[model samples]
Target chain A: MDLLERFAKGDDAAFEALFRQFEREVYGWILRIVRDPAAAEDLTVETFWRIYKARARFDPQAPFGAWARRIATNLAIDHLRCRRSEQELPEQLGAPGAPNPALQREAREQIQRAFRRLPAKLQAAATLAFIEEKSYDEISDALGVSIGAVRLRMFRAVRILRKEFNRMGLKP
Target chain B: MTKLENHDDVRAILKKGFPRIRAADEEPRRDLWPAMLRKLDAHALRQRVPWYDWALLGALAGTLAFFPTSILLFMYHL
Candidate 1:
């Protein structure tokens, strides 16, 4: 039998197989939500640790993909909300590898300065819907908004982000 | 975005930049089965006691019930 079939029979190897296959996608999803690699890594680890802890309580017959993805989405959304409440988040993917630290730093600051001009709700909505690539259904579920609201919010968010990028001489 | 939407640029960014994706478990940690078995052991035992255990308790209650009225009558006569 395949590993999934074995997993249904309560096999450890089967669970490990699923974990190995999905962990990368899970981490990437978290990173897209948080935009901070460190936080994403931490939360990714926490997400899996939580699943392991809750494994026995899991009905093996349940839809594992949906169950695992939901846990990850919830953790990331909560993390982002808390961070937003504390202070503004910087708006760069990561530090550039170029030798000019000062110039790179200044450029990043300029981008952030522009990003902060967008409405806060738009910023939050963009990160989840665009960068995170969360489905409209998932975004609505996470944000407690209607699907129509999520769609409207995403449309407005991209327009704002595009304008912000354009001001920095970014074509896209 | 029409072109970008069809193509996953963010996905490309991730696939290019981040390569370290660890599995959701402690590798080489203590054997996992022992812990799973222990949890499974504790899980189902709390629901209902054995039939024999209830039978014994029921018998004890029945004996106590018979003696209670008899003792009350004896005390009244005394």
Candidate 2:
């Protein structure tokens, strides 16, 4: 039988093999959404654990990478939902090639604060669409939504963020 | 002004506000198999029934054995 089929039947070796193959992709995807390496690592492990447990429901014929990404996205969204709105994002996540480090850092902090205030779903959509520059199709696939839904989410996210930034009087 | 107005301005603000961090695209530093194993082991440990629960089950079974009529009550409660 194939690796997915074996995994579905509770084959430890097959599970480990799949984990070895997909761990990086899964972890990288989660890291992009959560933007915290440590938390991403933990969530990566959690994602695989969930995959293994829910193997019975998996269809062997389906593409594993997309399935794994979907699970990773859900876990990242959950992490976002659970995070305190006021908690500062990790300082290590500095903007690339900022002309002024101090001012850029302050701007990034304010933006992140506003970004985090968004509903978790909108945050995920906006992150994937604009920040990461992922395609609407890929974002929709990962988010388990239609392309139209992704567009709507992006619109809502931008609108809310604009309102929040205007209120904060912090123009980026 | 309405929420939908200034659409391009707000989109630009968001993009500028949240620039992509360089690290987001990189793969994890270390192999995560061992961590996955540890999480699996922890979940397994948690799934085991404690002695108190077994003792409670035994007491219920023993009581049911003494008074079979109570089986109906137990089923009803369940």
**All candidates' TM-scores?**
0.46, 0.77
User: What residue runs in model 2 are displaced by over 4 Å at the alpha carbon?
Assistant: A84-100, A170-172, B1-8, B21-25, B45-78
- State in Å the error of residue B26, model 2: 2.2
Off by over 4 Å in 1: A1-11, A56-63, A85-107, A110-124, A132-146, A152-172, B1-78
What is the CAPRI rating of model 2's predicted complex? acceptable
Q: Which 10 consecutive positions of candidate 2 chain A have the poorest summed lDDT?
A: A88-97
lDDT of 1 by residue, A68-106 (tens): 776877788677656654334344433333468775565
> Residues B3-54, candidate 2, lDDT per residue (tens digit)?
2344556656666666575753567877788888998888777679787897
Looking at model 1, residue A112 earns an lDDT score of 46
User: Looking at candidate 1, what is the lDDT of residue A106?
Assistant: 53
Displacement of residue A138 (Cα, Å) in model 1 is: 6.5
lDDT of 2 at A78: 97
Candidate 1, residue B77: the lDDT equals: 80
